[model samples]
Target: MESSAQLVIFAGLAIGLIYGAVGLLSGFCLMSSMRGWLAEGDGRLVRTYALAVAVAIAASQILAGGGTVDLGKSIYLQPTFSAPVLFLGGLLFGYGMVLSNGCGSRALVLLGRGNLRSFVVVIVLGIAAQMTLKGLIAPARIALVQVSQATANSNSLPSLLATLGLGETVSRTLAAAAIVVALMLFAFAHAGFRRSPGQIAAGIIVGLLVAGGWFVTGYLGADDFNPVPVTSLTFIAPIADALQYAMLSTGLTPNFGIATVAGVFAGSLTTALASGRFKLEGYSSPRHMLRSGSGAALMGIGGVMAFGCSIGQGLTGLSTLALASFVAVAGILLGTAAGLRGALRVQPLAVA
Candidate 1:
């Protein structure tokens, strides 16, 4: 059992590294995609992100259907519903990502590019995330969770389909196929989108990474004595956890999400150094720095409330087909739109 556990840890780390590298290379960022669609009228990046969501949903469902994993065990599919918190959290996180000019994952990648501004944003985000997760704001979050709890089934669409009288296998298969087909059609329909290999590959690989995370924790990390939390990619809390781990390594064992977050910074650094993309860039003015820091702080608090950041809820949570995730995603979209329009127009910082 000890050896098996060790193997599982190693596998999880490997998956994290691959995810980091792929994410860095492909520039997979939900905030950037939304901003591009809203500000520039370029929908390719958004389409790629949508494609990844669809793929993640199909693949994760297939894993659950095969009995290799149980999607219900994940946090996103918690039986207790908190609609208000999820929506509000999503809005905060989405708006913050716009102000910061990137989401958590994007910050990691930018950190590698030697962007000192992103480093500040990431550090603030991590610290704030920790505060919301288990620090000063924890009690408030706990109270909210308690107040808004609801009893409901926490299964994927396919599982719901089974509940509705469809055969389990057929329902799972059909649901997965339908989503995959729809996503593919959307991604490939446009000539320009099809030609952008970077965007397309990012969608596919990131989708696979979400499934890989599930396999790591849900399958490999399942131990009788010390089972790991069934989770996948999410930047907010993990960044906080990573900070905590650095300070209290003796008290906490390394988890998959923290390890993955660390891997992203490392991977991006490696890629940047090798490609000569590394540079020391910081905020041009104090006001700009303040804006970035405030954005990061909002993301941390919001991510905690929403239960995820872009990759967390957008890809990982949605892959499970939880109704809450859908709500959160919708909130994120709405928030991003608001940020990109009207008085919320914040100047975007140049990529470092």
Candidate 2:
């Protein structure tokens, strides 16, 4: 038990450290990438995001193919997928992330750099996620899940392709390769993106971290006596878990998510301090606080509903080629666009 726990902790922290360092350096926010593309007509960052996703899928699939990881055991590959939860949750999370000026993962990084406003966002997001997960909203959320859930032949595209008559290995290989190649071509086609090596490295590192996350949890962390849930980078539930662990650690054992959450903060803080970027920051007005708080709440609730946040469904879950992840990512993009231009825009800076 102790050895397994130690290994899980070590694994989680290693991956988390890489995530924090690379994420901070790269400014890897899916919401920001979407905004850059839609609002600013800039595709460079978006391409970076694509590269990360592409690399993650290829690397993870390779692991699965070689039997280094059991991708099916992950929650993203469940037989039944909650379409409503993913779509609506992704929508809310997208808009809320925009409103907060960052996603949940970004908030953690910012908080590490002494952004008190991010602290508020993190606290609200954590509490709201807990509420949606198991607090006051759980009943309603579960009811929604029960009604909206649909059982699929398989949630993964490769599996679906296999079922449609292709050889299983061929189906998986072809699908994964196609997506990977397409995304890579798209990412590299941008001349500006091609010129930015730092950004490219960032994308690759982030993607490998996702694959590393799978390897750590699925293989190294897997144990019959003290099993850990196989998962990768995600912020919603883990934020809540971190909060709960801080309060009730005596009664609860720290898990991968919680450890990852803490490592992100620690890693970011260290990097920020070393880079001389640490500075105290807070809301400028009461209105700013209210706006940020509302956005945080929305992110928490929406992330749980969707079963993951931007990075969760966007990079990690999508890496699995899960159908629900596709829908959820689409919803996130749509919602982000809506928030950027439509009447639903949560523009506290401009609107307030």
Count of clashes, each model: 0, 0
What's the true lDDT of residue 267 in model 1?
A: 78
Q: Whole-model Cα lDDT per candidate?
A: 0.82, 0.88
lDDT of 1 by residue, 246-318 (tens): 9999998777777788778887888778888788888888878888899899899999999998889999988
Q: With candidate 1 superimposed using the best TM-score fit, by how many Å does residue 68's alpha carbon deviate from the native?
A: 0.7
Clashing pairs in 1: none
Residue 126 shift from truth in candidate 2, angstroms: 0.5
Question: By lDDT, who's the top model here?
Answer: 2
Candidate 2 stretches greater than 4 Å from native: 348-352
lDDT of 2 by residue, 1-352 (tens): 4787778888888788778877788888888888888778988889989999999999999998888889888889998978978899988988888888889999998888889999999999999999999899999999999998989987888988988789877988998999999999999999999999989998999899899888888888878888778888888999999999999989998888988998888888989999998999988788888888988999999999888988898999999999989988888887788888878875647533
Residue 42 of model 2, lDDT score:
89
RMSD of 2: 1.4
Q: List TM-score per model, in order.
A: 0.93, 0.97
